[model samples]
Target: MLELKTPQEIAAMRTTGAFIAELLDDLQARAAVGVNLLDLEYRARALIEDRGAVSCYWDYAPSFGRGPFRNVICLSVNDAVLHGLPHDYTLRDGDLLSMDIAVSIDGWVADSARSLIVGTPRPQDQRLIEATERALEAAIAAALPGGRLGDISAAIGAVADEYGYPVNTDFGGHGLGRTMHEDPHVSNRGRAGRGLVLRPGLTLALEPWFAQGTSKIVYDPDGWTLRSADGSRTAHSEHTIAVTEGAPQVLTRSLTGAGLP
Candidate 1:
């Protein structure tokens, strides 16, 4: 069922979103060359505890992945794009790393993801990252009352096509609230003005992810990491937002800065 958030529920989500946003920012800053993926995970675990929050990914036994996620955040490097399980690998120069996290505060949840290059970045990888960022921005802009969900998906597909990257629809954005996943799955590719109608109070996690080479992805033996099938690089960008009368409110974005709000 597609549930619309009441004002109070929305406010609670905003607080959760704020914590997640700041945590992501902190992890990004700390993911430098020589840093281990598990190190980042531990940091996120501590931060979540500091806020009296809970990690939605912990003990998340989804149908597709291995049982009991047991991690606070997802760390995908290079060819890996989604559902990555953190390990002992240390960051290297020019490595494209994606971090995804979802946390609950006072029973409200917000999810967000970001891809970046550790140390120096390769030109092609940088472009791929920018493509997802642009696509995410476009998708956010399309989340307006009186619009359809397809508008957001179309915006993402258009940007990926403009960048000549293929999109894999197996996993994409989704509606989230009290729990992690919810109704109205948001595909990365769709026709404009199609699917469910958008209205105020609807909160969604709009994500755009792509591979530099092929759209096909293969699962790791770990049963969680999703990597490019053709050994190509990948990137992912996401934001949890709410449809509003004016511009959509980016809940997972900083509310106290010129860059956000």
Candidate 2:
């Protein structure tokens, strides 16, 4: 069931969103070449603890996930896309990395993700990251009150198509509030005027992820990481948004002034 947020609830979510945005910014700064993936997880844990925030991924055990996520954040490198389990791998130059994190602050939840190239970046890798970010922006613009959910999905898909990337509906966005995931699954592709109606107080985590070569993906042996079946690079971008009376509000905009790459 979709639960709308009250004014007070939205206020609390704004705080949670700010924390998540700052956390992602800090993580992106530390995710340089030669940094181990496990180190990134540790950094996230420390930051969450310092802020007295609870990690939504630490013990998350969804139907599709392995036992418990057991990590504070997700670290996907190169071919890996979603649900990436951080391990002992060190980031390398020109490597495309995606980081996803969700946290609860004072009982409110906010989730966001960003993809960046560690050290030097290849031209195509930069383009992939830009494409995902552009798709996310388009989705946010379409998330206005009275608009249908499909409008958001179609906006994202249109941007992806313009970049010559195939849409993957296996995993996408969702409603977010007191929990990390909730009602109203937001797909990356859909009809322009279909699906649920958008209204005020409808908060959603809008995400757009794409693989460079193909839309198909395979699960890693770890039971969590999802990699491209064709060994192509992937990029993901996300933000927690609120449908308002006019333009939708992006709750998770980075506090560092460094927008998505």
Candidate 3:
């Protein structure tokens, strides 16, 4: 079912969203050459714990993921895009890394993701990240009340297409509220008028995940991480937003204010 949030609920969700936003800011700053992915997970856990927040990823048993995901955050590097399980791998210079995080405050959940170059970013890599960021912004801009879910989808697709990047819709955004995942699954590409209609209190995550060469993705042997099938570079950006009386409210927004949250 597609869940709608009450004004009070939305306010509560904002806390979860803001906390997640701040945690990501700290984590991204700490991610650098020679840093361990597991260390990122630890930092996320500490942040959540210090704030008395609960991690939605851990203890989450979605069909596509393994039971009780061991890590508090996703640490995807290079070809890896989503559901990146933290491992013993250490980030190196020029490594394109994506960190995905979700948390619940007083039972309200918010999710977000970001991609960055570990060190000495390459031009092509920077371009990919920038494109994904712009695409995410466009999608969020289309998420206002009275718009359809497809409007968001089309906006994101247009940006990706303009850059000649392939969209990976298999793991796009979705409705989020008391739980992390909800109804009315939001794809990365769709017709402008298709799918559910946006309305006041309708909260959803608008994420644009793309690959330089192909749209297809494959799960790693761990049954959690998702990677590009063509071994090409990949990027993903996302924000959890709410369709309000006028414009949409981005809950999981970045500190930079460039994303809808």
lDDT of each: 0.92, 0.91, 0.87
Q: How many residue pairs clash in each candidate?
A: 0, 0, 3
Clashing pairs in 3: 240-261, 252-261, 253-261
lDDT of 3 at 234: 88
lDDT of 2 at 59: 81
Highest lDDT against the true fold, candidate: 1
Off by over 4 Å in 1: 257-261
TM-score of each: 0.97, 0.96, 0.95
Summarize candidate 2's per-residue lDDT along 1-261 as a digit string, tens digits.
Answer: 899998788878888888888878888888888999999898888889988999999888988866888998999999999989999999999999999999999999999999999999899999999999999999999998888999999999999999999999989999999999999999999998999999999999999999999999999988899999999999999999998888888888754564323
- Tens digit of lDDT per residue, candidate 1, span 146-260? 9999999999999999999999998999999989999889999999989999989899999999999999999999999999999999999988999877789989976654321
Candidate that beats the other on lDDT, 1 or 2, i.e. the better one: 1
RMSD per prediction, one decimal?
2.2, 2.3, 2.8
Q: Determine the backbone clash count of candidate 2.
A: 0
